[model samples]
Target: MGNEHLIGYARVSTQGQNLEQQRERMLALGCTRIFEEKISGAKRDRPELLRLLDHLREGDVVAVIRLDRLARSTSDLLQIAELLRAKGAGLRSEAEPWADTTSPAGRLILTVFAGIADFERSLISERTSSGRSAAKARGVKFGPKPVLTPSQIAHASVLVNWSRTLN
Candidate 1:
């Protein structure tokens, strides 16, 4: 980690949210550059995150204020780790001491976190599926409601036919 400049990443879930605190923390930690993004961690296509990944040097370290700010799930975290490892870079979180890739303990801690995140996501998915299934069984309609009723559609067709005949 010596001589490797720390690159900071700050993210917020929405436009209304503030990133000042996260940015200030990362800057205080001696981050040379920061990529601030206003997007959900659950979202896969973050442009700033992508730029940060692309801008990484072989010896650079990506620093985030919190682990959750960098990734939403364990699998996502692991994927990010793999990407950094491939690029000869590393990741660190200020809030989660165990998330520092510069040390063996941090690596182990991140691994454990990934497993937990995966499990939690799976549980949520299962519950959501069950709820949707129950709703379907209850004859609950899904998707957008019709903008025009059947009679309105029939009237529209009649008007169209009359206009076409005249033309």
Candidate 2:
């Protein structure tokens, strides 16, 4: 594909799981380079994914066996897509044709998903702010209330000292 590199990323959720199938698929799809890892999807500290993202260049393509293997959330997916797009790279998922970044429809879908993620984040922020404001207005204390007031703590310390002297 015109000196473009096809970079593949394969991931498994745990040590027990294997990457054989995913790796094989990427190889079959003509991936010239690949990154493999065994890590939980919930973890945000995937070394291989970060490396792969950073390694991509213009005209490069990132491929994965499945969409879920690529990221933990829609926001994460969108962020990866944005990064790839910024570098003039594209994304492709073997199991999800709609996620192919090389196609116009696929790009449109990703844009919509990114927009939705943004909207969802804004809504969550607004709701949390409103809730905090209401709580403060009602004189609700934040964080764990002090375990013991200053007077109570002083009394406890005095009792402990008195008991130690008797012992």
Candidate 3:
């Protein structure tokens, strides 16, 4: 209702997805500027996202195509929302109109959903840890195979010695 600028943020987790749909939606919503990222949702250190956050001003609105586009985890979502609140900015998710942070009801709903997401993450972590422990007890190996074999190590040592002589 005020003279606030509407900004849009769109992201795709993989290379196969396109940002055209999100761009069109944000444009239809009268967004003046849009920031887009092509990265995994699990990655927290996205450059474009950080740039958009830094560019936000008081009374500005940040719109995203979906909640997952903004954050992959509850903690991340809460952190981003808190930052927006502190900056006097609002968040609007196109996928869930109830996620508009400008309204009291939307704030309450987002908080409840954040709690649920946190609980789900905890449960998943517990299950994963339990499974890993059981697998270890059964003598199963985890993680990627060692890249350097004994022969390769010896060859690397020889190379290192040769390089040291040149130095």
Candidate 4:
């Protein structure tokens, strides 16, 4: 450390889950501040996570027990890493030694993994688009159903015209 702080973030998916273990681990790591939340990692709107990110200062490190505890997907992890980099902060996972962004080797490894993840996402997007095109060619309809039928629209139009005539 020095003047930089090691902040911890602990999360569990459900109300029944306990955060004490994670909290104790963070304490053992000598974290100065900790943010705890009981929410699914899949959700995008996490108030505690947002607050932790907002509170980050330059040269600070965000310590997590595991990388999965922080993000559910590779893209999500990379996004958080990018944000940390932009703010001159770093991320460290105690369970995953290679995930320490403060070191040069760790940064290199993360970048390589990010490139692979991007390529995989592109392939999946292409396959999905091809499947959607095939379905459309076979007369599969998309989007919501019409709110009013043709008959209903015609009747409403007649009523409007009659009202205008009387006016």
Instruction: Identify the leading candidate in terms of lDDT.
Output: 4
Candidate 3, residues 1-167: lDDT per residue as tens digits? 35668899999988999999999999998899999998998886899989999999998999988989998876788889989999899999888889899889989988897888789989999999999999999999999988999999999999999999999
Give candidate 4 regions above 4 Å deviation: 1-4, 146-167
Worst 10 residues of 1 by lDDT: 106-115
Give the runs in model 1 whose Cα sits over 4 Å from its true position: 111-167
lDDT of 1 by residue, 1-167 (tens): 46778999999999999999998888889999999999988788999999999999998999998889988877878989989989999898888877898889987887787788789889999999999999999999989999999999999999999999999
- Residues 43-149, candidate 4: write the lDDT tens digits: 99989999999999999999999998899899899999999999999999999989999989899989999999999999999999999999999999889988999
lDDT of 4: 0.93
Q: List model 2 lDDT by residue over 1-167, tens digit each.
A: 34568999999999999999988889889999999999998998999998998899898989988999998888889988999999999999988999989889999999999888889999999999999999999999899879899999999999999999999
Better of 1 and 2 by lDDT: 2
lDDT agreement of model 2 with the native: 0.91
Error of 4 at 167 (Å): 10
- Model 2 RMSD in angstroms: 5.0
Q: How far off is residue 162 in model 1, in Å?
A: 38
